[model samples]
Every structure is written in C-alpha cells, then in structure tokens.
Target: MAQLSDDCFAFGGDLMPVHAALDLLRSRVAPVTAAETVPLADALGRVLAEDVVAPFDVPPHDNSAVDGYAVFFDDLQADGETVLPVTGRVAAGHLLGREGRRGEAVRIFTGAPMPAGFDTVLMQEDCRPIKDANDGDSVAIPAGIKRGANRRKAGEDVTRGSVVLATGRRLRPEDVGLAASLGRKELSVRRPLRAAVFSTGDEVREPGQELPQGCIYDANRFALIAALRQLGCAVTDLGILPDRLEAITEALERAAAEHDVLITSGGMSTGEEDHVKAAVEALGALHFWRLAIKPGRPVALGQVRDAVFVGLPGNPVAVMVTFLRIARPILLRLMGAEESEPRLFPVKAAFAYKKKAGRREYVRARLARGEDGALTAVKHPRDGAGVLSSLVESDGLVELPEDLSRLEPGMTVEFLPLSEVR
Candidate 1:
C-alpha cells in the first residue's frame, strides 16, 4: 500500500473557504503511488509517470493530400491548359520507381509519396484525360492551379524529439492513439490508489437486509465505493461498522494496514452516538475542517499511521457532492494526477435564489432549451441536503460563488456538470 510521508494537513479555523481549502490541499499533498508499465491497450485513464518523446516525424515523407496528377509546377502553361504525358502511377503505399523530368506528369492517389523532382499536384476533377494514337496517355492541366496546393509536408503534425505527452497527465483515448502513432507499444503509469470505504451509525443497514423502524438502508457506502472505482481506485468495501468506539477503532486499524486511504460516512459530527471521531482520534490524528459550504459542512481529514483518512457527511447528496468536489482532488493527487480544477461552463439562470454571502453553494439544476436555442438552468424543486432524488432529476449544479447573495433569472452563472466530475 502507498503511504503519506508526513501528517501536516491540519486546519485550525472554525470554518474555511472552499478555495483556501483546495489551495492548502494542493500545496501539502503529493503522489504516494508507485510507477508501473502497462500496454497501450490498458493505458486509458491512468496517470503518466514519465514524459513521452517523439522518435521521428509523424508522416515520415512528403505525400499527396488528394487523388491527382503530380508534376513540376514550372512545367504548367501560364496562359492556358498544358497537356503532359502520364508517365507513371503511385498509390498510398507504392512510390515512383525513378525520378521524373520537368515536363512529365504522374497519376497519384491520396497519401502517396511525392516522386523526386515533383512539386505540385492537380486534382483529377479539374484535369481532363485524353488518349491519342501518338501519345499513350496524357492529362490537360489548368493554368490557374496554385503551385504545391495538394502536397502535405513532412512533420506537419509532429516533429522529431518533441515531448508529445507530459508526466502527471491522465491518458485519454486520443493520447493512446497518439502513442500508437509514435510506434510505442507500452507506457509508464502510476498504479491505482488503494482505498477502503465503509459507513458508520447503528441506524444504517445493508440494502437487502430488513430495516427496523428507525433504521435506513446503507447508501453512502455503496455510492462512495462506486465513486472511488470511477476514479480508477482499487476500492474495498468494509461494510457498515456499528457506532461503537472499540469496534470502529479495530476495523479502522486493520483497514489502514492494507489500504492507502480509509473513507467513512456519518459519525463525523459531535453527537452522543458519533463514535467515529473518538475512534479515529484514538488510532490516528483527526482534524475536523468545518467548511463554509452547505450540506457538507462537517468533514474530517487526518492519518492513521501512514495511511490517510477522510470522514464525510452522512446525507447521500452531501456524500456525492463532497466526494466529487473535495475528496476527489485529494485522491487524484495521491494517484499522481495534476492538481487541476474541473471545468465549469457558463449558462443562463432560470430561477431565483438567495444564499449567504460568505458561503459557497451548489444548487441542483437541469438545463432547458428556449425557443431561441439558448440553454437555461432550471433549479430543482427540492433543496434539502438529504434529497438524493433531486440529484437524479437534475443534470448538474449551479455554482453560486461566495460574493453573490442573490441570483436572478436570465443572469449568467457558472455551472458544474455532474458528468465532468463523476
């Protein structure tokens, strides 16, 4: 398992701003996972461990960009059509056997290498072909065609000895294709982060089990496990731990020994039955970071020995939001990914909202297209933090910044799509 070098991410403030918390995380966290080599077929979504350099030019030779006739540009007539004999033919893979003289034309197809001494191409549609008794085959070239118009120069896409992909970048499908184009079979990448997820609270029960009057099915654990898996983490489900100090402590100790990070939901607040805080404090360091954000105000971060620990809120919606916005970045950094923020798009608001000026808020909303083909964000009817169904009904969240106190309709606001993070 990967481990932290030191435990230095503790904030003493009662409430911290969202940006300040993210900035602190970026400065304090470092990648803990080791590097490994994997084939190109299995490289997608993995963080690159080293830079990839191009060995040679992308298209090793100058080639024709279209099916046409190749010839010397100076041979064409300046005033009218010029007829030249079609002395040779070339296709995608085949090349002309020998160099040609100035007055000769070669029938060439797209991606065919340009023959020696040839500097121009005329499209087949613009040139007329003729057959005669004296001349075997010839094409009538238009005088106004530009010189070198249909030729593709070598190294136009990529140059030799240039860095094509940098370290700490998460490989995408196009990145893999580029590596294949460079004739690379495998890539060096960071190993996936090992994570263990569980839920606490005596009122929580498994989905298939019978629930008592005050008990509810465990949704946070399953949700967290799925989210962690989506982020390419090797997630182990520790099940639901009862709200007992000793039981929680023992389970956490065993899990911390095997995993890089331990994630738990609920039992983070200062309540009588919340034994998670006490248990984590006994086994490791627990720092409660009271964020000024709604729904996920109570979050804990610390370490057990060498493994990192994260305690999130109990509500399902808060669990998803906090995980996506906060814990996701931290885990990504530990997995060797760059500290980058998710892209937020601007869209017109279709609802009015009032919020505290100093706290950041994310409102669940869906987009609707007007008759003019403009997208407008429509806020969800339900606003409760426990309303998990609202997240399902909406497409993403309308991010209200700390300075904004009121949101009116038709105003442009930054929107964070769930697809961007999840």
Candidate 2:
C-alpha cells in the first residue's frame, strides 16, 4: 500500500493558510506505485503509470487530406492552368504500385498515402477533368496550388519515439483516442483508488424517508459519492451511520481497514454531537486545520491504519466547497496524479463586495457577456454556506484571494469551475 511521509504535516503554529496546508498535504503523499494494463475501454480517468511512447510515426506515411489529384508541385504549369494525365486510383487503404511520372497525376482519396514523386494534392473541386488521347483521362489544375497543400505529412501529429502521454496523467477521452490512433490496444494505468463515503448525523435522513420534525434530507453524501465515482474511485457507500460514538468509531475502523480512504461529513465541527474527529483521534492521528478560507473554515486530515481520512463539514455548500478546495487535491494525489490543482481562469467581477483580509473565499458566480462584450462573473445574491442552491445555480466559484479586502466591479479574479473538481 502507498503511504504518506512518516513525519506528520506541519500545523503547530498559527492556523494553516490554504496554500501552505495544501502544499504540506500534497508533499506528504506518495502516489500509488502499482500499475496494471487495461484496455482503452476502461482507461478513462485512470492515471497513467507509464509514459506512452509512439513506436512509429502517426499516419505512417504522407497521405492525402482529401479526395483529389496528387501531383509534383514542380510539374504544375506556374503561369497558367496545367493539365496532367490521370495515372491511377488510390483510396485510404490502397496505394498505386509505381511512382507517378512528371506529367501525370494519381487520382487519390482522403487518407491515401501520397504516391512516390508526388508532393501536392488538389481537391477534386479545384480540378476539371479533361479528355486525353494517349493517357485516356487527364485533369486541368489551376495555377498557384502550393506544394504540400492538402496533405498530412508522416509524423506531423506524432513523431516516432516521442512520449505522447506522460506518466501521472489522467486519461481523458481525447487521450484515449490518441492512444488508439497510435495503435495502442491497452494502457498502463494506476489502480483505481478505493473510497468509502457516508454521513454520521441522526438528523440526516434519506430523501425518500418520511421527514420527521427537525430532520433534514442527507444530500451531501450522494454528491460526494458521485464525485468520487467521477474521479474513478471504487466507492463503497456506507449510507448514514448511527450518531452514537461507538457506532461511528466502529464504522470508521472497519472502513479504514477495508478502503484506501474514508470520507465522512457532518462530524468535524465543535458541537458536542460531532464524533468523527474524536473517533479518528482515538483510532489514529488527526490534525484539525483552521484554514483561512470562507464557507469551509475548518477541515480535518488524518490517517487510520493504511487508509487516509478526509473529514468534511455538514453544511451542503460547505461540504462541496471544502471538498473542492481541499479533499479534491489530496484524493488526486492519493490516486497518483502529479498535477492535482484545478484550472482557474481569470475573469472580471461584475459586482462589488467588501471582504476581510487573511481569508480566501469562494463566491458562487456565473459568467456572462457584459454590455462591453467582456466576460464578467455575476455573483449569486446569497453568500450563505448553507445555501446549496447557490452552488447548483452558479457555474463556478469566483475565488477572492487572501490579501484584498475590497472587490470593485471589473476587478479581475480567478474563477474555478465546478467541473474542475469532479
């Protein structure tokens, strides 16, 4: 089993800053070293454990880009229209047996390897057919048809011996298609990380269950499970655990022994009912972090046996926000991905708001084309961490860094799409 560094992460001084805590967490994790070969069908979202090197040049040889006539550029009449005798036909998988003569052209289709001695192709639309006595059929080509036009050169897309996909990359659809284009039947990827997700509040009931007075539906667990599935983890849904300390403790211990990671929500707060932190501390080492961030002001990271524990808060919005801000990167690292940080794009803010210094905040916002034609982030009206509707209504989070306390309209800020995390 992969393990984090023996020395615990640093958090003794003041409350850990967001970036500092993230760095410490990632630095301590050692990506899983195990690897297995899987067919391309099952490779999506799997981290590559080996660099995919192209054994041969893509296209294998120069080929036609369209159905047209292939000719030597030098053979074309530069001053005016040039007529050439049609020699033979070539389709995607078919090639002419012999090289073309200077005064002749090969009728070629898309993806057909360029016949020897031919370096240019003219689309069928650009050439007119002409009758010929000796050659039987010929083509009238216009002048100024540049050399190498309408042809895909061998190795243009991918060169031989080049590393096409590097190790630690999570395979996307395009990446899988690329491997197929290079004739790769299978890929070496890291084993999928196993995770268990559950809730621990007696007040949190399933959606279909008859709602008792003062009881709410458990929404965070389902969302967390979905996100884990999207990240390619084999998730074991533990459902809602009983609120008893002994029950939660036993569940945590069992999950720790079985899964690589244990993710639980609603028990990291300071309330007396919170039992996740206590259970984790009793079973293993737990580090509670007061990260300088809004929505998610507190988070807990710990290890139980060989499994990592990510304790998330209860508020629906806070759960999603904290998961994206902290748990996402740590889980990615545990999955053997070297680059776990989500992509953030810069856009202008459309609203004004005052913020406190020394805390990073994620404002729910949607992008719109302003009257000036520039992309701007329109803030959702509500900023409450409990308002899960804001997360659903907005496209992403507009991250306000920890330095500036004031944000005026048109100020540029980093926007992280919800898609980035899942």
Candidate 3:
C-alpha cells in the first residue's frame, strides 16, 4: 500500500476550464496502489504493471490460409490449365513428410504449415482431381493465380521480441487472450484501488427504510458505488451520514486510513447544513474546482489524510457527468493505468440548441440512423441536472465545445457514448 502527498490536490482556481482542470489532475496524480501478479482469469480490468514481450512469432511457421493445394506458382500454366501429381497431404498441426519437387501439388488444409518448395496455393474448389498418365492422384490447376497467394507468413500477427502489451494498460479480454497466446499463465498488475463512497444530507434516507415526511431516498451513494466498481475499484459502502460535522469527520478520518479514495455526493454545496466541506477541511485540505462545464460545475478535489477525496454535486446527472469527465481520469491515474478518456464521435445534430460562450456543455442525446444510414443525434427533452430519467432514456451526451455558442440542425457534433465509460 502507498499514500498520496498531503498537498497533491492543493491547486487553486476559480471557474477553471474543463481542459485546464483535467490537465491539473493529470500532472498531480500518480499511482498509489502496489503491484501483484494474478492469474489471467482474475486479471481482466486490472491495470498491467509490466510490459509483455512476445517470445516467439505468431503462427511460428508459414501456413496455408485456406484449405487448398500448395504448389510453386511457376508450375501453373500461364493461360490454360495444367495437371500435376498430388504427392502428399498436410493438415493443421501436421507437416509434409518429405521435400516437394517442382510441378507437384500437395494437399493442404487451413492452418497447415506449407512444405518446402511451395510458394502458392489454389483453392480446392478451383482445382479438379484427375488421373495422370500413371493413373495416380493428380490435380488440374488454373492460371492467373499470384505468387505466394493464400500463404500466411511467420510473424504475420506478432513478431518475436516485440512488446505486445505495454505497462500501465488496463487489461481487457483481448489483452488477456494475447498474453495467453504468448504462453503467459499470469500477469503482473496493479492491485485494485480501495475506495469508500457515501452521501450526506439530513433530508436523505435509505431506500428500504420507511419514507419520511420531506425526505428523498439516497440515489447518489448507490450510483457512485456502481461507477467506482465499473472502474475496477474495491468500493466500501459507507452508507448515508447526516449533516453533522462530528459524525462526518469521524467517518472520513477512519475511511482515509484504510482506503485509497473517499467519494461523497451532496453536502458539497456551501450551505449552513453542508457540514461535509467543513469536516473534510478539518481532517485534511480541500479545494473547490469550479469548472466551466454545464450541469457539473462545482467539483471538490482534495485529500482526506493520504486518501484522495472527491466531493461531487448532489444532482444525479451532475454526479455522473463529473465522474465520467473529471474524476474518472484521476482515479485511473491513481490505479496505475494510462490515460484513457472516452472517445467522442462526430454526428449530425437532429435538433437545434444554444448555450453560453466559454463554457462546455454535455447534452443528453440519443442516436438515430437516417434513411441514408447516417447517424443523427436527438437531444433529450429534459435538461435538468436532477433529471435522472433523462440520462436513462438517452444513449450518450452531445458535447458542445466552449467556443460553440449555438447549434443548428444537421450541424456536426461530438457524441460521448455511455458504453465507453462502462
């Protein structure tokens, strides 16, 4: 286990641009988790700590790409058909017993290693089995086939001594498969980040508990927990804490000593009942990063003792947006993973919209394919930060850049698909 510096998130700014805030996080944050080796089955979603080198070339030998007859290209007639004796046969994992001579075809199947003196293959369908003058096995081949056709060269997919997987990569299924291809039974990866998540507010209550007169069920805590798990963190559900400075401070101090991160929604706003900010400031340092982004503007980044503290807005939509765009990058860096921002794709806008200049906005939108097969983004009807249903009904967000103040129909926009974050 490792710990972050006390002043890692001490940078101060007001109404910082989204890019500037991200740049700060990237510059300040580093991995705090230790490395350990795990079996390939348990390595998925874990951050790789070592670079993997290919010990040998993929395929290991020149093989046929399809079931066909392997022969020297020169053996075929230039403009007509030529008959040749079928001397031997080869299948996957098998090789020709003897060297093949020119003007002879050898039966070969897909993945079968090509024999010596064979450079081209003709599909079995194109060649006709016929009888030669000796009445032995023979085949008729056609012309116009190129040299070295249907032959997969050694190292075609991966070369020996090449770095197949790099350090700090979050292991995906394909990454695991590549390691298996290299005969690796286990991989060295960074341990999962231990995280504690909670929500605060006197008006919030548990879902299963009896409904109070003017209270809403806690949703932010559950949502944050799910998001943290999706990022491969081992989350501790700290439950809901009332708006009391003593209780919040006690929980934060205890959790920070055991976890790598402490996440909470609500009680971040500056109000009389918002004791979270005061409690965090008492135990460690706290900084409010007022980003110039729509829906999610007031993001709190700081440290609770050695553990990183993330205070997100109470609104459901804002919590998700800030987590995806802001906190996600910070958490990934702390997990020893490389920067992997979700990719945004360009699509034509199906609705017109406008926003203030110099502020980035992410509009919830669904994608629709037009008759011409082009994708168009349809904005959701609701744009409130508290509208959790809007996020559920939408596919992803239509990102409006800081310089773009107005948008019209058919205009191109970048879309961040929800799947990318998951």
Candidate 4:
C-alpha cells in the first residue's frame, strides 16, 4: 500500500482539477491482481495478457475468388479462340493435384483451391461451351486477360509469424473472429478487477422502499455498478451504509480484505454526519482533492489497507461524470490495461455558453450535422449535476477548457463521445 502526504489529505478548499486528481490517484495505485487464461468465447472485453502471432496464413493456400475457369495463360492465342478439355473440377475444401499438362483448364468454384499449373482464372461468364462453338467438349477463353488476375494469393490476408494482436488490447467481437481464423481457441487475459461498491447516508433508501420526507432512493450505486461492469470488473454490491462511524468502518474493513477496490457515494463532503471520510482516515488514510470542474468539484481518493477507495459525490449526474473522468482511468490502470487517450473530435458549438476561467467544465450536448457538412454540438438545456436526464438525451459531452470563460456560437470545441470513454 502507498501512503499519502498530510497535505493530500486536506479537505474543504478549492478542489483539484479533474486532470490533477486523476494524476494523483494513478500515481498512488498499482495493479492488484494479474494473469488469467480465458476461452476466446468468454474473453470479450478482457485485456490481453500477451501478443498473438499468426502461425499460419489466413487463406492457407491459393484459391479461386469466383466460380471460373482456371487456365494456363500462355495456352490462349492472341484474338484466336482456342478450345481446351476441362479434365477436372475443383470445389471448396477440395484440391486438384499438379496432374494438368500444358494447354489445359480446370473447372473451379469460388473458394476452391487453384489447381497446380494454372496461373490465371477466367470468369465463367467470359467463356462459352464447346458444343455451341466449332470445338468439341472444350471451352473458349478470350484474350487480353492478365495472368493470375482473379486468383487469391496465399497469405494475402494474414502472413505466417506476423503479430496479429498486441498485448493489452481489449478483445472485441472482430478480434475474437480474427483469432478464430488463426485457430486460437483460448487467449491469455488479465484477471478482472474485483470492485466493491456501496452508498452512505441514512437518508438514502432503496427504490422499492417507501421514501420518508427528505429522503431519496440511491441511484449512484446502480450507476457505479453499471460503469464498473462496462469496464469488465467483477462487482460486489455492499448496499447502503448508515452515517454511523462503526457501520461504515466495518464495511470498509470487510471490503478492504476482499476486494481490489472499494467505492462509495455520499458521506465524503465536509459536513456533519459525513462519516465516510473520517472512517476512511481512521481505517487507513483518506485524501480529498478538489477538482476544478463544474458539476463534480469534490472527489475523495485514498487507500484503505489493501483496497483503493474512491468516494464519489452523492448527486447522480455528478457521480456519473466523476466516475468517468476520474475513477475510470485509475481502474483501467489497476487492471494492467494499456493507457490510450480518449478519442476527441473537433466540432463547432451551436450555441453560446458562459463559465468562469480556471475551471474546466464538461457540457452535455447533442451532436448533429451542420449545413456545412460538419459535426456541430448543441448544449443541453440543463447543466446541473443532478439532472441525470440530460445524459440520457445527449450523445456525448463537449469539453470546455480551463482558460476559456465563454464560448460563442459557431466556435470550435472538442467533443468526447461517451461511448469512447466507456
């Protein structure tokens, strides 16, 4: 376990910016568990543990691209129709040997192996039967067809001994299909991170329960759990904990002993009954950093024994934003994942917006094609962190930099697709 400085534990001030908070969290945490072998069918979304090299060519041999006639290119005379006996036929999964002599042709179907001694393929439409012509039991091949024009060369798709997939890549359906093409039934992948999630505050109730006055159902837990699952984590739900120090501490202790990381919402701010922060410090150490971002300003990060602690804000929208901007990266790193920057696309803003300088803000926006055939982002009507509905209606978030205070309509801004972040 890594220790934090006393200054890092300070709370209740100007929060660190989102980027700065991420840097600190990543710097202190390391991967908890590693290496596991999983069947290719079950490996989707898992991080690769090693590089995959192709042991054989993709197509494996020269084959016909279409149902056509495989012929010797030199046997055809210039502008003169020549008849050749179709001695053999080749279909997919069947091969014809090198028994064909000079001036011969073989009837071949699509995906069939090209017979030996044949260098070119003429389409079936281009050739006519000998019975209709002056020749007997033979076909007429036209001139001007290049040699080997329609024959698929061996290893054209993937060469032997070539590195097909690199280590640390998250396996997608296409990647799995590619691996299957190379005859791999299993893959080495990193073990999924075990995440324990909970919510704190007696005012938080389960959805089915009757809501007392001044109480709300806990939505952050579901959001956190879903986000963790999206990142390929095995999640353990700890439910909601009261504001009591003992109950919170007991949950933290159990979680630290079992999970790679422990996460919670609420009870982190500097207010009465905020026992999460205090309990975390008493159990191990708690570091609260101020993020210079709108909607999600205060984020608590620390270590509890062996488990990394991530305390998200109580607001539903804030929980989602902070989880994506802060915890997602650290979780990836802890899973031994290779770091790749989020894909950001440049888009023009459709409306004007105002914000203070020195604080970065992510605005939920719907993207549309402008009249100029370019992508334009229109800001959502609501910017409050509690407005979870905004995220449901938007495609992604438009990033406003820390130095810029105002954005005018038609101004260029960076758009980060939510799909890319997950």
In order, the Cα lDDT scores of the candidates are 0.88, 0.88, 0.89, 0.85
* Sequence-dependent TM-score of model 3: 0.93
Tens digits of lDDT, candidate 2, 284-308: 9875555777777658788877889
lDDT of 3 by residue, 1-422 (tens): 65655532223455778888888777777799999999998999999999999999997899999998999888888999989999889999988987779978999999999898898989999989987677799999988899999999999989999999999999889999999988999999999999999998888899999988998888888888898998899999999998899999999999999999999898876668888888889998865446788888768788999999988888899999999988898899999987558899999999999887887899999999976799999999999899999999999999999999999999999999999888
* Candidate 1 pairs with clashing backbones: none
Q: Write the per-residue lDDT of candidate 1 for residues 31-120, one digit (tens) a residue.
A: 999999999999998999999999999888889999999999999998999999999999999979888688999999999999988999
For model 2, where is the 10-residue window of minimal lDDT?
Answer: 4-13
Cα RMSD to the true fold for all candidates: 6.5, 6.2, 6.5, 5.5
Which prediction has the highest TM-score against the true structure? 2
Model 2 segments more than 4 A misplaced: 1-14, 133-135
What's the lDDT for candidate 3? 0.89
Top-lDDT structure, candidate number: 3
Runs with alpha carbons beyond 4 Å of true place in candidate 3: 1-13, 131-135
Q: What lDDT is reached at residue 146 by model 2?
A: 87
Using lDDT as the measure, name the better of candidate 1 and candidate 3.
Answer: 3
User: After TM-score superposition, what is the CA distance of residue 209 in candidate 4 from its true location, in Å?
Assistant: 1.3
Off by over 4 Å in 4: 1-14, 72-85, 99-102, 123-147
After TM-score superposition, the amount by which residue 88's alpha carbon in candidate 4 deviates from its true location, in angstroms, is: 2.8
